[model samples]
Target: MPKSKRNKQVTLSKTTKKGRGHKELIINGIRDAAEKYSSIYVFNFQNMRNSKLKEFREQLQSSSKFFLGSNKVMQVAIGRSSSDEIKPNLHKVSKLLRGDAGMIFTNLSKEEVERLFNEFEGYDFARTGSIATEKVELKEGPLEQFTHDMEPFLRRQGMPVRLNKGVVELVSDFVVCEEGKPLSPEASRILRLMGNMMATFRLNLVCRWGSEDDFELYIDGPGDSDVE
Candidate 1:
């Protein structure tokens, strides 16, 4: 009988997993960008929104490059110690990639970068677990903003709402969310329905490194501390 190959097992030893390949790409990219751009900045973000980030990246694509991925991989790309650093004092910048952070390699001046970072802010709807920025209350009256068909949906979200003659009515005063408190899932949904946005996405420069030996820390930036 001919040799059967149907049950043969194939070895994956020569195959690289997608994740590992991606990490390698990121590492190589950072290293290349390091050599291309004169300045590198470590930045941390809050309330991240991918759409806004994509837009921001597009705007700076001509003069800068951004690297965001596994912190460990990024650390390795720039080196984690004085001995292994790809550039002088880059190990210090690696230490700043501890949390929700990334790096930007840019040819722009410090003033220009600072102004851009300070001015760039993206706002969107608040999600559950986010702190409510302000109290949102619905008074006991017809909610003209919502249609009558949304009464059931509103009620399901814990809103004291009902259909009153083809209109959505609040049966009683409803406190959707309180300022300074963590927003609940119900509250988040209600806020979305009411077109309320409470989340602000912004980036803060943690540190900056020059191609040579120059390095500086932004004391007011996020993750400001001694290099680990």
Candidate 2:
């Protein structure tokens, strides 16, 4: 064979080997995730810039119980597995896979995972594109209406609402979800409140786990006479 032809064959072989290695790594990651975690959250982030993506990844790592590999590789590994328990959740997750996607696996229950997500809610201030479920944007109409309705509800919870240049703001720290935009001062307070409430609920559930007291707490709110 000519020298050029020989070189081409070697390059193709190397490329094929690299692809196989990557697939193996993905399969391994999925197996590990399944073995270690009872719950998984698959997030699809689209059009995120490099810097923002890095920040998001770092945030997830710090907050999540465990963050795993890409969806494509994990899907293949999951497909081969015999576990039916996570299968349903994984199938539902499959639908969310689009653009640049990632998975978070955790031994923590669904409620716990949700609490983590809520905790990390507003860490990234800038709009780094959007998730498939909620698109972030800046506008005037519905967001204003939402802010109006939310203000009273927030105050009832012992939180205050402030207005910044015609925009409603939360006086106390809270988690604010408007049309998906994360606005500071006003909106940040709302989001903080919501996140705190979710954390409280999760803590209550965890405290009452595996007892008749827990059952009563679940059926009715805390302070049930039978619980104690």
State each model's CA lDDT, in order: 0.90, 0.44
Candidate 2: lDDT over CA atoms? 0.44
TM-score of 1: 0.89
- Model 1 clash tally, residue pairs: 0
User: Which pairs in model 1 have colliding backbones?
Assistant: none
| Model 1 C-alpha lDDT per residue in residues 1-228, reported as the tens digit of each score | 999999999986797566877888888999999889999999999999999999999999999999887899999999999899999889999888877999999999999999999999999999999999899888999999998788888888988887878988888999999999999999999899888989999999988997565788884544455574
- Scored by lDDT, the top model is 1
Give the poorly placed runs of model 2, Cα more than 4 Å off: 1-18, 46-70, 80-89, 119-228
Clashes of each: 0, 13
lDDT of 2 by residue, 92-154 (tens): 344343345566655555675556444542223332222112332233322353455465665
Least lDDT summed over 10 consecutive residues: which range in candidate 1? 219-228
Error of 1 at 75 (Å): 0.3
Question: Model 2: which ten-residue window has the lowest total lDDT?
Answer: 198-207
